[model samples]
Target: MLFASDLDQTLIYSHRSLTPSSKADPILPVERLDNRDVSFMTQNALKLLQELSGQILFVPVTTRTILQYSRVNLQGYGICPRYAVTSNGGTVIQEGCEDKAWKEQVLAGNVNCADVRDLLSKFREISHPSWVLKESDKLADDLFYYCIVDREKMPYSELDDFALWAGKLRWTLSIQGRKLYLIPYHVSKKSAILYLQEKEGLSTLAAAGDSLLDLELLQQADAAFAPSHGELFLQYQMGVFTAKRINNQGIQFTRTSGIGAAEEILRHVLKMLD
Candidate 1:
C-alpha cells in the first residue's frame, strides 16, 4: 500500500493552531521555518506516522522547495520514507537522494509549459514592492516561483486576475495563507505519485490534503480525504470538488484540523488496512 500526505497545514500546523493554549497540553515545535516561525504536529500524530511508516510506503508530498522541505523534522524512531515529492513534483527524492530520472521527466514533460521566467515578469507587473516580501521570493530550481505577500495590503481581485492570466498560459496559481505559488500544470503531486506507485508496484493509494494542489492527488487515490476548512472543503461543499471513490467508504473530512485532522486521517488509514 502507498500512503501520500501533504505537509504544511495538513499534517503539520502553525502555532496559531494550538487552540486554547492555556488548557491544551504543552506542544513541541518540530519544523523551524524561516522568519523564526515554527510548525507543530501532535505527539500522537508523530507516533502514528512512525507506525504507518513501517507498514507501507509513506510519501511526503508537498509544494515546498527542497530547502524548505528539509527543515521539517519528521524524524522519529523509524526509517525515513525513501521518497518525497517536493517542488510540487518537480523533484522526487528517493533514499535521501533525488531520483534524477524523475527530475528529467518533469522538465521534459513541462517543456511546453510557459517559461518560468515569464511568471517572474508577470509578478513584477502586478506586484507592489512593499506588499511582496522580497526576502521570501524564490524560484524553485527555475521550475516555479513563490513569495510571501502582505495579504491585508494586497487586493483579492489582483490575485484573482493573476490566477486567470496564469491559467490561460497553461500555468496555475494558488494562494496558501500568505504564500503564493505559480506552477505549471504538468508539474504535479499526482504525476509523481503515479510514477512512484508504478515503480514500487504499489496496489492501493490513500491520500489527504486541504488545497487545490492536493485535489487531484486525493481524487486520483484509491482512498482519499480532506479537511473541512480549506479550499478543497469549500469547493467540496459547493459541488465543485468530489472524491468519494467507489473503492472506499468512510468520513470524507476530519472532525477537527491541524494535529486533530492528522490523527483522524491516520486512524482512518489504520482502518483501511483491514
Candidate 2:
C-alpha cells in the first residue's frame, strides 16, 4: 500500500493558517527557513504520521521545488519518506536523489506546452505592479512560475480571462492564497503518483490534498481526503466545485479546520489502513 499526501495546507500548515482554538495545541515545527518556522503540525498529528509512515510507503507530494521541499525535515520528527514527488510532479526524488528517468519523462511530457519564458513574458504584460507584489515573481525549477499578489486588489475579470488564455496554451492557472501559479498541463501530482505506483508495484493507493492542483490526485486514488479548509473545500462549500467520484466514493473531508484538521486527516488515513 502507498499513501501520497500534499504537504502545505494539507499535512503541514503555516502559522497564519492555524486557528485561535488550535493555538493551545502542542505543535512541532516541520519546516524552517532562515531561523524562522514556516510550517508546523500538531503533536498528535505528528504521532499519527509517525505511525502511518511505519506501515506504508508514505510519499510527500508537493508543488514546491526540490530546494523548497528540503526546508521540511520530516526525519527530525521520526518520519522519513523514501520517495517524494516535487515540482508538481515534474521531478521525483528517491532516497534523497533525483530520479533522472522521471525528470526526463516529465520534461518530455511538457514539450508541447508553451515555453516557460513565453509564459513569464505574458504574465509581465498582463500583470500590474499595484496588485502583483514587486520582486515576488518566481520560476519554479523552470517547470512553472508564480507571483505573490495583493488578493484584495486582484482584478477578477482580468484573471478569469488570463486563465482562459493560458488554458488554450495547455497551461493551468491556479490561485491559492496570495500566490498565483501558471503551470503546464503535463506536470501534475496524479501522474507522478501513478509513476511511483507502477515503479513500486503498489496495489492500493490513498491520497490527501486541498487544492485545485490536487483534484486529479484525489480523484485517482482508491481512497482520498481533503481538509475542510483551503481552495477545494471552500469551493465545494459554496457549491461551485463538484468532486468526481472514485468507485462511487467522492473525496472525504475532515470535520475540523486548521491544525485540528491535520490530526483528523491522519487519524482517518490510519483507520483506513487498519
Candidate 3:
C-alpha cells in the first residue's frame, strides 16, 4: 500500500517549533524536557508507522516549503517515507534526492507563462492590504504554480478577497498554515497522485490532511484521514456540509492523541483490506 500524510498541525504541533504558544495545548504536553520542545504523537500511531514503514510505501504530502519540510527528522522516529510530496503537490522528491520532472510538467501545462505572473501581480495590487505581507515568487525548478502572501501577514478577509479575485482568472487559492497559494485549477494533489500511479504502478493509496486544500486529495484516496482542527473553521463558516464532523470539524480528538487518531484510522483501513 502507498500512504501519504500531511505535516504541520497534522503530524507536527505548533509548539514543537522553536516557538511555542497557546495553540500547543491540545496536542502537546505541558511537561517540558530540559531544552527540547516536544510535540505529541500517539505511541500506537508511532508503532503503526514503524510497522507500515516495512510493509507499505509511505509518502508525506504537506504544504511546507521544501526547506522547512526537510528540517523534520523522521528517521529518529524509526520511519522514513522514501517519496515525499511537498509544496502542495508542486514537487515530488525522493527522500534523499532531487528531481525536476514535477516542475517541468507544471511549465508545459501553461500556454501563457507570463500570464500567471501578471494575474498574480494584478491580484496583489487590487487587493493589497496592510495585513498582506510578502508575495514570494513561488516559482521553483519543478513547481507547477506560485503562491502569494505568507499566512501570518495575511488577514482572513483579504485572503477571502484574493480567493474571489482568483476566481476571475480561473485560478484557485488554497491556504495552508500561513501561506496562501495560487495554483491552476488543473494543478492539484490528485494530479500528483496520478503521476505517482503512473511511475510506481500503485493500485491503491491512503492519504491524510487537515485543510481545504486537502479536500481533493482526501476524496481521491482509497482511504482518508483528516485532523481535528485548522481550516475546519473556514469550511464551517462557508456553511459547507459533509457527512461527518468530528471534534467540531471533520474529525474530533485530542491533538496530544495524534497516535490514537492514526491508529483508529489505520485499523479501519486494515479491516477493509482484510
Candidate 4:
C-alpha cells in the first residue's frame, strides 16, 4: 500500500497553526530554519508518523519548492520517506534525488497550458500592494507562482473572477491561508501519486491533505482524510465544497485540529492497514 500525505497544515504545522490547548500533547519541532523552529508536530503524532513510515510506503506530498521542502527534516525524527512529491507534483524526489524522468514528464504535460510568465503577469495586474505582499510573490521552480496576501483585505470578487479566467486557460487558483497560488492544471498531486503508484506497482492508496490542491488526490484515493483546521474543512463547513461520494465513504475528517489532527490521521491510516 502507498500512503500519500500533504506536509504543511496536514502532517506538520507552523507555529501559528499549532493550536495549543490545555490537554494537548507535548510537541516536537520537525522543521528548523536559520536556527529557529519553523514547523512542528505533537510528540504523539511524531511517534505515529514514525510507526506509519515503517509499515507502508509513506510519501510526503507538498506544494513547497525543492529548497523549501528541504528545510523539513523528517529523517531527524526517524521517519525518512523514500519518495516525496514537491512543487505541487511538478517535481518528484526519490531517495533524496530528483527524479529526472518525472520532472521531464511534468514539463511535457504542461506544454499546452498557459505559460507561467503569463500567469505571473496576470496576477500582478489584478493584485494590489495593500493586500498582496510584494516580497512574498514568488515563482516556484518555474512551475507556478504564489503570493502572500492579507486574507482579510483580499478582493474575493476579483479572485473569483480570476479563478474563472484561469480555469479557461487550464490553470487553477487556490488560496491556502495567506498564500494564493496560480498553478497549471497539469501540475497536481493526483497525477504524481498516480505515476508513483504505477511505477512502484502499489495497488492500494490512501491520502490526506488540507488544501484545495489536494482535492484531486483525495478524490482519487481509495481512502482519504482532511484535517478539521484546513482550508477544505473550512470550505466544507461554509457549504462551499462538497464531494458526496468521497465525503460519505472514502474520506474521513478528524474531530480535532492542529497537531492532534495529524495524530488522528496517522492512527486512522494504521488502523485501516491492520
Pick the TM-score winner: 2
lDDT of 3 by residue, 81-164 (tens): 778877677777885774478767866766533367676677667445454455554554334344445455556776677778
State the lDDT of candidate 2 residue by residue for 169-226, as single tens digits.
Answer: 8999999878899999999999999999999999889999988889899989999899
TM-score for predicted model 4 compared with the true structure: 0.95
Compute the lDDT of residue 109 as modeled in candidate 4.
Answer: 78
Off by over 4 Å in 3: 16-40, 112-114, 127-129, 133-165, 176-178, 233-238, 241-260, 270-274
C-alpha TM-scores of all predictions: 0.88, 0.96, 0.72, 0.95
Top lDDT model: 2
Residue by residue across 164-245, what tens digits does model 4's lDDT show?
9889889999888889998898899999999999999999899999998998899888899899877889888898867544
Rank ordering of all candidates by lDDT, starting from the highest: 2, 4, 1, 3
Where does candidate 4 clash, by residue pair?
none
Which regions of candidate 1 are displaced past 4 Å? 21-23, 33-37, 152-158, 237-240, 243-251
Native-to-model Cα distance after best TM-score fit, residue 53 in candidate 2, in Å:
0.7
Colliding residue pairs in candidate 3: 27-256, 42-259, 103-142, 151-178, 246-251, 246-252, 247-252
Q: Candidate 4: misplaced stretches above 4 Å?
A: 22-24, 245-248
Q: Residue-wise lDDT of candidate 1 within 150-190, one digit each (tens)?
A: 87888778778888888988898877677888889888999
